[model samples]
Target: MSSQRSSKTFLQLKYGEALDTAATKKSITSLLSSHDGTEVIHHCLKEGARWGMSPDSEEPNTLEAVYILSGKLKLHRPNEGSFLEAGDFLAGQPVSEFIVLTALEDSEFLYITSNPVFHYYSSDTRNLEMLAIEIEKKDGYTADHCFRIKELSMLVGEKMELNSESLQKLHFGALLHDIGKTEVPESILLKPAKLDEEEWTIMKEHTRYGATILRKTNITHFILAAEVVEQHHERYDGSGYPKGLRRDEICLEAAIVGLVDSYDAMTSERIYSKARSKESALTEIKQLRGIKYHPEVVDYFLSVIE
Candidate 1:
């Protein structure tokens, strides 16, 4: 297992390579490009002082560790803005109102927390390694499934011209949509044949289970991600469940996830059924477009596979 210190060093090295320029007018946007992997674990970045203010509604209880790598920043809490210089390290129980503002010169900082207020990024190597370990532990196939679905979903999202931020959410959401299945019964999940009605009902609960699990993280992105997990099983015509949300009732991110998830399920070999050829799966998806899946999403997937 990687130690916290090693993880921090890895993050620092990655961040440096992406944001080392000293002369340019650096903003949160520039900083984010270097810290893309970490974004899934954190929420939005505040650029300069223009809009990087913290939430003021309620005080947070989790702890946050901030390590400054370069330049300077004014840390604003409810009462004051404290100036923090490079090489400074601060740790505090989460405050309801806390924000960071970068100085005119380029600045860098690392934010770490166990609470789920932001997104965490994992590179392909990390994701694959984690999946391998999960498989070794005999957890299930969900992790491996997530990895492929994320790749396919991103491909479709890019072809559809989704903005960078939305694309990132879609990618992470796909990986996590079935995370709730962790609460499901292993026998039902790995059954070699079809599920009985009772088993099917239990299986369906995975969505709600996933959402609930993510909600405990207290991260805003996971909140959005939770919604995706809850609604990924919902159908366009209002026949799907937990909630039978219809049409635009479902979030766009959830819809993207739903489409890719279905595609993967149909195309991949499972314990219950043999995998369909990609062509056959595409044909089925095309036939169900608009009724079962979003038409635009279907079109994008087709374009990519073609």
Candidate 2:
């Protein structure tokens, strides 16, 4: 509900000057036109790109009609999946289940919706970005930590040949992994020595906090990031907090973030621990491969940083 129909009766938007715009690595969305809560959007997706929407009960009554203007697509929903092609149309709302569209090839589409979603999505992304900045500044030991993690995670994702959409989710997941730490006390966050058992327990709750913060946004990308944030601490050997998921039970994106986070934390200065040399860190990571981190993630990450 961030945008409303303008008072003016008529308007014109040039091809290059869209009303609103947003993009990810695999797709670009342009708010080409709007009228009385109805939004006409233009989407260009790279081959194999994917878009997902999860159920949200708090959302206003909303519906969407998508017309595939060009190329092929596949629709995936609970217990059903179908293919789409040029001129095909589908309409529905994610009221109680998840919906996903995957581009079978380079494609273009028109998405007409009763909800003016672009504004809300754009606003949420901006606000969350600002929040990430604030969170980073709040933690003295984590200066630029999120940024470094994001960069490293992307490299590993690329080395592993993850698609664009997966990479985008990994990007935000790594950048906001520590957002839950905002709830921790400053005394504990800035403590000069190692944390006691109680403080460690509280610190471990940051993953849950980060997941909750993201889910509250009700945005698809954030929802994916929330999963990664929550599970990033879980070890491959099933020794982790909040959940004991191991190996394939963990999200691949979360596994990547966890590995990169460990390496970065090992090499970065912290109040309680001295920075380890990069060689020492890699050696330690090698020693723990398939035990603390996913085996494949460790292989690619070591190759990337090497």
Name the top lDDT candidate: 2
lDDT of 1 by residue, 122-164 (tens): 2432442343335322433443565567657766765565643
Q: Highest TM-score: which candidate?
A: 2
For residue 40, model 2's alpha carbon misses the true position, in angstroms, by 9.6
Clashes (backbone N, CA, C under 3 Å), per candidate, total: 15, 0
TM-scores for all predictions = 0.58, 0.64
lDDT of 2 by residue, 1-306 (tens): 112222101111111222123232456778999999888988887775555444445554667677899988776543445788999987766334444566779888887877667665445554555566566666654545666687689678766767544655686688788888778787786777788999999888989999999887655667767989999999999998669889999999999999998898889886567899999999999999999899999999988899
The global C-alpha lDDT for each of the candidates, from Candidate 1 onward, is 0.57, 0.71
Determine which window of 10 residues in candidate 1 has minimal summed lDDT: 1-10
**Model 1 stretches astray by more than 4 angstroms:** 1-143
- Residue 46 in model 1: lDDT: 27
> In lDDT terms, how accurate is model 2?
0.71
